[model samples]
Target chain A: MINNRVFPWLDERLGLTTIYKTVLDRMVPKVNWWFTLGSATLFLFVMQAVTGIMLSVYYVPSPDKAYDSIEYIMTGVAFGWLIRGIHHWGATLMVITVFIHMLRVFFYAAYKYPREITWTTGVFLFLLTLGMGFTGYLLPWNQKAYWATTVGTSIAGSVPVIGDFILRDLRGGSDLSGVTLARFFSAHIWMLPAAIIALIGVHLYLVIRLGISSIPKENE
Target chain B: MARSGNVTRRGFITSVMAFAGSIMGIVVGLPIIGYLVSPAIGGRKTDSWIPVGKLDTYPVGVPTVFSFTRSKINGWEKTTNSYSVYVLRGANDEVKVLSNVCTHLGCRVSYSKDTDTYACPCHDARFDRNGVVLSGPPPRPLDQYESKNDNGTLSIRVLES
Candidate 1:
């Protein structure tokens, strides 16, 4: 068949058959729906990235115009409401799925022994995900957003010796001015995203490198 | 010995290719990254004087509502925002522009002719014609915009919050 000829041609030039055999033919323990949460989290992350990028195409990050721009997106652009709604809901869903995934890993005690690196990286990933949510919440610059951020950053100022420094660093100044909006906007869209992607790469590499931990049997 | 020599040559070729590939990646990636991040670094909204309307249109001794649209560009995205201001013009050409947003929770305050006061539906806050809080939960007076009357035309300078 033509399929046989094309596959062999590709296999000869690219060693596709060898890669498939090595990666896809590996054995895994029989897992239930709980084991699928990790993949679900990954899918949600991709969805968030795509939707977030679409939103950034029209979102303004300045305090003076952020709310207005959001209004424009909601009323003027076609399907803008749908996209924004999905992004809003998707973020909440991603947080939930990630939390559930972590719980699954912990309850299974998969974080023990040789998988220590994987667990540690996962902890960082969880914190990074929360950071993304916190930063993104302020981009709208509405009343709730402004007040919530004011309170949130003030809490950071309550930490000991370096507290003021942390607050100033987060807000880009002593107060939540336009500079704070700009800072959070950049962190939400750029810095945190880069960190998340890098961490995800390493996490996945570790997972594959160590192979998935099997479920503990009743007698074992 | 022949097999060992062949393996060493393959290893050397692989390392050289890896180095070349990385160099190419940097050369191609830097410009793309710069293009993407330039907006975040350089795009700060500047204060500008936005024209509202002609001075005579605003009635004296009463707060007349005027709505205007301001277009903003953040990076590549452009959006138009509609804003409303209560313009109070005095007999002696004294002009005051008050933001409709409530001081309590940032809700839009509307003029109620029945009560002759500006009221917020969000928290039942009220403000007099001069924008001073009359009742309810407003923490402060309504915000005012810096306005100018130039050749019978009125404009307001919006400041960054």
Candidate 2:
């Protein structure tokens, strides 16, 4: 009785009833555990954002102090190890889920017709996720990070005429110096996150607009 | 017509609510913007003289290992780090403090007395007594801290890369 009265009041004030009927009253086809991968990927992204924020609180981006700061976070800060571990594992899990989601969409022919834009956005999001991984890998500033980045950027330098340009842009110079660390730190923490968030907005909007695709059947 | 000239009840309330919301957003957003941009705009590293040890303790004509604890504050995080360096004292009382980190890949380089060189265990990079790169994949010489001998105490100013 109270909900009836309160809901009417809210609907009268904010038009909530109209929004609920339009957005929440939609029909969804029968889906199994496979359908949950997209939601799982979304959940992992949120987890990454939360843990990444906590990490940014203690992570220093300089060449001089980056590794030490991570060590401090792992050993010194309270519950730091758990949070960092979650962030690390969450990133790996997100990549896995996103790949699975893409495969499910492709194999079911869900990307056909109206869902082409959705598939394209998903591809972009996949590349951005990989970019996030690559950039975040270098922020630790360990021997592995330093050498791997040197090797990674050198591969970028192997691309035809634009190779050196891409390499210099990525490293911020001819050599992997402090500037590279700072640049990667900024890209990892700020620019990529911002881009991912914006892309996620579009991706979610498209998903909702088109509704979830049903699994392909043997017969029509 | 006169009733139409007056604002509707819903319109007046919504206008007031929107104004309040804008004010709230500005109040919350300003500090967040400042916090995000401060690290990029602020000075890179804090400059200070770290005291290593006494001049008398460092043996002459030998690379004595000295480890010192330095606290570094970067934005919101503060870390107390123990760093090692090789301090070689000359006959004329001049001191050379070489950073033990290899120039190749930032691994800790240890002094091998038998080989008379600082060798990195990670990549087999070697540096001679003068901190010059001897062999392997090191691109440059080992880094050195600017050391100062004040009276009988030794202090060093760490250079940022």
Candidate 3:
């Protein structure tokens, strides 16, 4: 028998086995390539996590030396640039794939009554991915990263009365500096990931619960 | 009849064949897919200082853009790649290298000799002589790099931070 400790009461509370069965048996269609993008995006997330952790081992987040440190990783560390590159490109690609997946849903009108929550949750996840991308881009603190982010956040500062408040919260100051790095670091590593993972679980759960919609025929 | 058993056996064999084909296809296809997508997925490995070129190749009082490659690592793999740099030989004969990025809005800065400044047309921030903030909405000075010259060849290491 499997260890009760492994499965535990949490599994029962989550209804893990039943949920899995319903998802495998009912929801996910044994279709062609259209369904695979979601899994691919999830897989890319795992890749980002692994590569990002490896990079963090050597990344020092400070404006004074963030650029030098990244250079050192790219030049001195064994596989540093590779990890950074993967993190960089993987982020963009994830955003693209998720966008296409959403488009696929929209084109098919899959966001009908029962699936609205799924669509909404997916939208939240999409925004979170973009958040991850934007925040993570600043961690390098290169001129490109620094100036690009400065301009990007300045747009946030244009949101009327609350714009300054939001911009200050984002940069941690009027200028992008040590505090800004810290804020982006925290967002990239902790806050956004936590939010994304939690929502993803809910999203998958809803997908399982609702079951996959029949492929929308053009006429009907 | 004897033919009925043969028909059942044929159906069973066909099902087995399809299942085996799918399993084998997955087994074969996964590694191929992983390999093809690994660069974007895992990242390219990089290391070492990329060499730019000879010092005399750039004239004093002129800005020359040079490019080089660095090796990067992602997990167990390594990749060497090219990146660009903008080097300015100042009027005072001192070599100053800056990232080709504008401080005001992250646009590429171009040398404008008539104005004697690096100007960002995006938002009108201008840096004169030593990358100091002169006008417009730039929060800081343009970035500078550590440069080296040996045997009349000038080389620089570019950082992505």
| Tens digits of per-residue lDDT for model 1, A12-121 | 99998777766667667787898887788888888788778877877888877788878866765555677788789988998999899999999889999898988998
Using lDDT, give the best candidate's number: 2
Location of the lowest summed lDDT over 10 successive residues in candidate 2 chain A = A72-81
**Residue by residue across A1-220, what tens digits does model 2's lDDT show?**
7677887897899998777776677678998898899889988998888778978887889988898888877765556677789888998889999999888888888998898888888899999998888898899899999999999999989999999999999999999999999999899888998998988888888888889888888993
Cα deviation at B159, candidate 3, in Å, is 33
Q: Candidate 2, residue A83: CA error in Å?
A: 1.0
Error of 3 at A35 (Å): 2.3
Task: Give the candidate order by descending TM-score.
Answer: 2, 1, 3
Model 1, B11-92: lDDT tens digits are 8989999999999879645644543354456445568888888998888988989888777764335668778999999999
- Off-target runs (Cα >4 Å) in candidate 1 are A1-15, A18-24, B1-161
lDDT of 3 at B139: 85
* Tens digits of per-residue lDDT for model 3, B1-161: 35554568778999999999999979645643443343355333433344567766777866667766566554333568654567777665568887667876788777777877878889878887577888888888888877877776776655442
lDDT of each: 0.84, 0.86, 0.78
